[model samples]
Target: MSEQAPAGWYPDGSGSERYWDGAAWTAHVRAPQPAPPAPPTDEAANVFSKLGTAVKKAASDKKASKDEALRLHEERAVAAGRLVTSGIFGTSTIEIYEHGFVRVAPGGERYAEAEKITKKTPYERLRSIAFGVPEAERAHDTEGPGSPIEGAVMQAMSGIVRGGKLLTKGTAVGIAATGVAHLASNSARKSNLVIATDKTIHTLTNQKHNGFIQVSQKEHNAVAVALVEAGNAVLGIEPVAVAQPSISAPPDAAPPAQISVAAVAVTPSLSDRIRELSELHREGILSDDEFSAAKGKLLAGL
Candidate 1:
């Protein structure tokens, strides 16, 4: 605004204090005043204490953040009806839901496979689920020795066997390959999750490179309980209490007995006899065998 301003600290209009010398802005800039320093040893101790406090506060904040995230995740899952039961098995996690379930792998190629499976499956189509270790896992073990001499002999034998007709059969080879592949891919799994619909069943293994989920007995029981509840709900089964029949004594009064009259021989009509027998049987007065015998006699007389 003027030809020249005093060569001291002045507002730069950017809210910072800057030094202007003679004609233009100078290299030197004015900064906000720093807090006064503490005593030498005390300063060092204070810095260390402050650093420790900051670290502790950071750790506490991080823990709270993780807890909040988990809480939100569970809430979302419940709202979506995608969480029936869940357990952490090693580094992986397995969730069982009413319609379907999702297993998150820890690492390796199986993780990709698990993701692919999850993408393809729609929860509505799921009907039933089962899980177990495959029986074919036995094939993963080799019987041969590692000695050089034995290796040479085995190699020679293997070459000789390769020329045989057995090699032409793809069934055995296929089975062996499949077993090996399954072993390698699912080595980390404690058990496989078998998801089934009306048409097909899918096998899911929770695995990482060397980590697998070990579901505890309590988690297993919880899963069973969830499945049972879901099945009952789906089947429209409801619980109800049955009422018991009450019998009251006839007013605690005795009726007068009729005196026996002189015998006047009278025979009931055929229809009347049949009805009387039926009534007696209905009232539990006649045993089944007695009723049959009496009915037969009465019919014969008719």
Candidate 2:
């Protein structure tokens, strides 16, 4: 019989024990247990973590840019005093007035005739005198002061009865020469006030034929304020509620799964092999028979 081995030692190395000399097991063999699989390193973890962070940052940046654009548009609209409603024209820093006058007849006789005139019998007698009898019968027998109805009819037709004048005035509120120039050019034909900016000044000067009123800075501001107030007053008839910007949902997070590096690695496929063989054949590197054989193999594998 073989001598008994030490207690801690196992035959053929299949136990977690060590051999000690003299006082303990002297010669022992034990199978080494494999090390636990290493935990992923920080660098590898950071790659995927950083990718997720970048996706979030990019979404935030896009939202910020959109918000900034919207803010700028609102600022421009407010500065320009643009109407909130569609199809309504915006107010400007200009003032416009139109005036006209109408006059009756020359003297008291026309006034008396007008006073006697009624809606039912409006100049009926005058109409009969003018169109009743034949032209020959209507002739005046006597000359001078008592001419038969000719002078009375002529008097009735003259003065403000058939003629009138229209007057228009346009004034620009606090504006520079450039502003005046713009007003003169663009609105020459129509009577209205226009606001001036650097872009419009040259056009205004070029079209100086239009009449315009140029006001001091203070007056311009006052006129602009007045116009804005007037517009607001009209708006007061039906309250205009400003629409608030819509709230946007937060962007979705990136996918949780990591993209495997192997997927993106370029490897030659069947098509690439065929193309390489075709190129080699064209360059006379392979004979037609070799090319055909290689191409057949590639197609067969496919």
Work out the TM-score per prediction.
0.23, 0.17
Model 2 per-residue lDDT tens digits across residues 175-229: 2323423322221111112222222320111111112332112222223334333
Evaluate candidate 1 by giving its C-alpha RMSD to the native, one decimal.
Answer: 29.8
Write candidate 1's Cα lDDT for 1-302 as tens digits: 24377676766777677777757787676765555777669778899999999999999999999898777666545543655555533233345554343333322332422233243233333465444432223233221244222232233334435662222233234324444223222221233444455445555444333222111222332343344344334434343233332365376645534442111112334664455456434533334555576567657654
What is the Å distance of residue 129 in model 2 from its true position? 58
Clashes of 2: 6
- Model 2: how far is 170 from its true place, Å? 53
Pairs in steric clash, model 1: 89-213
- Give the Cα error of residue 123 in candidate 2, in Å: 59
What overall lDDT, based on C-alpha atoms, would model 1 receive against the true structure? Answer: 0.43
Off by over 4 Å in 1: 1-42, 80-101, 104-302
- Ten-residue segment with the worst summed lDDT in candidate 2? 122-131
